[model samples]
Target: MLGWALTFAVLAIVAGFLGFMSLAGLAATVAKVLFVVFLVLLVASFVIRAVRGQSVL
Candidate 1:
């Protein structure tokens, strides 16, 4: 998930460099959304493990 966010971020940068404003904006939005989702899931996973007395690692 994080990898996908990074991929879209790079794509957005390249598209912006090439002057594809719409595509760049879309990719950047997608990257931001994916990154947020990834973080949320990561934190949830850690919380769940802690609740269950399991090591996060």
Candidate 2:
């Protein structure tokens, strides 16, 4: 979910600040993947609703 992505992003920032390069990189990668997945799901939901003649908003 988007919340999970944000959580990982924050973790990445904190890890980077603490100089945990490996952890930061891993967290950042997870955040990016989650965010992309979230966006894809969101768009798919919108398209589905539109096709059903329902409000996307």
Candidate 3:
């Protein structure tokens, strides 16, 4: 998921450089959403691990 977000971020940058405004905007939005989701899941996993008395790292 994090990888996908980075991929979309790069795609957005490239699209914007090529003057594809719509594609860039869409890709940027997707990247943002994916990044948020990734963060949420990461935190959740950490919490679950802590609750289980396991090392989150």
Candidate 4:
């Protein structure tokens, strides 16, 4: 998940550096979405793990 974010981020950077504004923008947007999804999923997973480890309420 994070890997994909990094990949798009790198692609965006490279594209921007090469002056491909449209591609860079698209890649950057993808990277942002991936990064956000990664964070949300990461945190949700931790919460789930913690809940599963706890005694029944």
lDDT of 3 by residue, 1-57 (tens): 999999999999999999999999999999999999999999999999999999999
Give me the overall lDDT of model 4: 0.92
**Clashing residue pairs, backbone N/CA/C < 3 A, model 4:** none
lDDT of 4 by residue, 1-57 (tens): 899999999999999999999999999999999999999988888888788896333
All models: lDDT? 1.00, 0.99, 1.00, 0.92
Q: Which structure is stronger by lDDT: 1 or 4?
A: 1
Q: For model 2, how does the per-residue alpha-carbon lDDT over 1-57 read when each residue is reduced to its tens digit?
A: 999999999999999999999999999999999999999999999999999999999
Number of clashing residue pairs in every model?
0, 0, 0, 0
Flag the better candidate by TM-score, 2 or 4.
2
Give the least accurate 10-residue stretch of model 2, judged by summed lDDT. 1-10
What lDDT score is found at residue 5 in candidate 2?
A: 100
TM-score of each: 0.97, 0.99, 0.98, 0.89
Best by TM-score: 2
Better of 1 and 3 by TM-score: 3
Tell how far residue 22 is off in model 3, in angstroms: 0.4
Q: Model 3 scores what on Cα lDDT? A: 1.00
Residue-level error in angstroms, candidate 4, position 52: 1.0
Output the lDDT of residue 37, model 2: 100
Off by over 4 Å in 2: none
